[model samples]
Target: MAPGSSAFKEVVESHPKQMNHKTLKMKAESGTVKTSMSLAEKHSIHGVHELLQCPTCAGSMYPPIHQCPNGHTLCANCKIVHKCCPTCRFELGNIRCLALEKVAESMELPCRYQSLGCQDLFPYYDKAKHEKHCPFRPYTCPYASSECCVTGDIPFLVAHLKEDHSVDMHDGCTFNHRYVKSNPHEVENATWMLTVFNCFGRQFCLHFEAFLLGTAPAYMAFVRFMGEDSDARKFNYTLEVGAFGRKLMWQGVPRSIRDSHRKVRDSQDGLIIPRNLALYFSAGSGQELKLRVTGRIWKV
Candidate 1:
């Protein structure tokens, strides 16, 4: 019978009938307490999670989360390469734990990234998967592919971008940046400039590009957060373009870094200026193109 069940309670009641009545009652009560306490222990973070953790790898046991012949548990991750239990040195293999699996199912646990601001609760089976893409999770170096392996929060990422990528950093949430495409007539489509804006302790990238939209030469500009789209929606940006008393404005939530600036631009989700309009903003007699763009970002 499951511990603390009515049947188990009856078994405890059957104990020591010949002993002193008071002592006998005390024994039954102690047994009741022990079994009742097991429920709390079985579901506690410090208790069950610790028990589930592999002795060697310290990973949580999720039933074929593995076990040794003598009943010590190990996570599935630690089961391979070691033939014996690390705790008891007993031969380890094929030990099914149907009872504990039921207990694991009964408990909801926080993601491993809980310390990083994730409040999500999940069963053991879903915790790791949710954490992998959790927005609150610390970001890896945006430049990870180049082997510049550093990781931290958003502020740390901005600092890394400045120190390592040597990316241009502009001050303030509001900006009046002048983008110069010097050769407006160039047939090639391209990204002209990228500026990093620091505000609200977060980093946003301003992308300026010159491209052809359906055979119409144009320029597109937009903002994207250094994090994921889910995070980007927490804030919004406004882009403004125009010089001679007329202005075109686009305002929207910043896309996540996962969405390439080109994707945002091609989505027509930002400010777009056609060739004629772009040239009018150009200084130096239209031979060069310059647009004095003004914009601001604020938390939504």
Candidate 2:
């Protein structure tokens, strides 16, 4: 292979192969070589790939690649936040690198999440869509009794919840729980309990919390499935709280843990009781709250 431009020379040195590439040459009327390439080598592919990277962010460049008068190039997004070329400090203008864009159109690349277990390859244009719905994407920890930021696959998260969060683990679809508070007025906007149930070869989380619903202090309880939204739709749960023949019931489908606990709580999709009603159900001291909550889960 013969030496071309500075970038082409680097490509030749890196990839030394003997394969004929498609002819990519151009000539102007004045006999001045606008573009010349005799890419009869295999080593130039990686060098061309490096040329598509934005010098500023080091990310792959797509369409509308901009350049400065000095020939320094950057992606369109970097061009917005910068007034001059990052390499040569030359004032930037609306100069598009059409040649590089054409090269990118001919290449295919792997997903950025390839290290995260996504073994898929796509054209430069189709990479983003595949990553959005990738099954191998990590899920956030569903433990809602605290501010936790752990994320991993489902099995790792289940183990983490039991060890790090000290969450209760049960083994049945039906459950009965009793919540007792000496000072109901002192309850703040916080989660009180989170229990996990292993049922039907899957897992579910039960959440109980106390928060201010508008100006009134209230209690809420709900269940969430430890899976995706589509699988969550295959089950239903009901919660009941009552005393002295008076009861409150809430029936709904379980939301997937994909929705954060705060999101589900803010939507108020659960059994809710005002402070006064809860105290009446306690049937004890005026300053005490002893509420019993029972729930059952089944496939629909």
Candidate 3:
């Protein structure tokens, strides 16, 4: 499509298939995108549904997206694997479904985080990306893998840890606690215990585990916030591990969610102690490791 005076002008030139859509793009370009709820008063939802589905993947197709020259539609990802439409086999040029998109622009879409109790209504085109890292998305208990695959929001997870797991909760950002991996000989990459701390009106997860970072029996402890990564930037946390003055400190903006706790340990985003240092801390008294980990979180 050629670049037009305004964003919607380009839409007008590219997507004028129906009478209503002839200048709809131009109007929308001039800041007149309507809501599906508003349009529902006049247009039928069925009209929007008929063209919203991608024939190849059956997923919802957003507008200004791709379609075949014959007008058979597919989501952008599905169209990547082939140059021709699956149904009509028409050469997949850069033809766009302008009218379909115009309708889509008006639709009130639900958040993908709806299952987690997020009720935000976004435009059809913005919902998927918005919900991926939405703060209200369902979260697993940060403690460990549990038979209780029960999901909850941040507050629910906080209560679950406090009551069910008996996790210790501290206020403010600074913490001076001793995290003990009593069974370092267990040799399984398992979490010993997880604690929670609150600071900057936000909650952070403190994960303590006995794992093998690189074949040496090691202990790792890290912190993660209970929100999206964007929210994580509101505060930064620092964890220091030391006993004999040889301290290892890590300061980073916590992740909203722990994609992989192991990945954080592997990347050494926290205070990681190998057998040598761990043994020094233990001082051959036993097969356990006691790390005096102190941390503080502050607003940015």
RMSD of each: 21.7, 19.0, 17.1
User: Residue pairs in steric clash, candidate 2?
Assistant: 15-43
Q: Output the lDDT of residue 218, model 1.
A: 85
Error of 2 at 25 (Å): 49
Error of 2 at 233 (Å): 0.7
Q: Please report how far candidate 3 places residue 280 from its true position, in Å.
A: 0.5
For each candidate in the order shown, give its overall lDDT on alpha carbons.
Answer: 0.65, 0.75, 0.64
Give me the candidate number with maximum lDDT: 2
**lDDT, candidate 1, 197-289, per-residue tens:** 766656778776667898988888788788766557778888888877878888888877655545666798888888788888663578877
Candidate 3, 1-300: lDDT as tens digits: 111101110000111112231110001111213433455643655566656888788788865578787777788888788888898987888887777788887766655565555555666667667666556667776666545566677778899878886676766557776655555566566445666776555678877667776677777777887765666777777877766557778888787554555555667777677767766765557666566767777768
Candidates ranked by lDDT, best first? Answer: 2, 1, 3
Report how far residue 57 has shifted in candidate 1, in Å: 18
| Winning model by TM-score | 2
List candidate 3 segments past 4 Å from native: 1-43, 54-58, 62-123, 133-136, 146-149, 181-183
Off by over 4 Å in 2: 1-52, 105-107, 113-117, 145-147
Collision pairs in model 3: 36-106
Model 3: worst 10 consecutive residues (lDDT sum): 4-13
Worst 10 residues of 1 by lDDT: 23-32
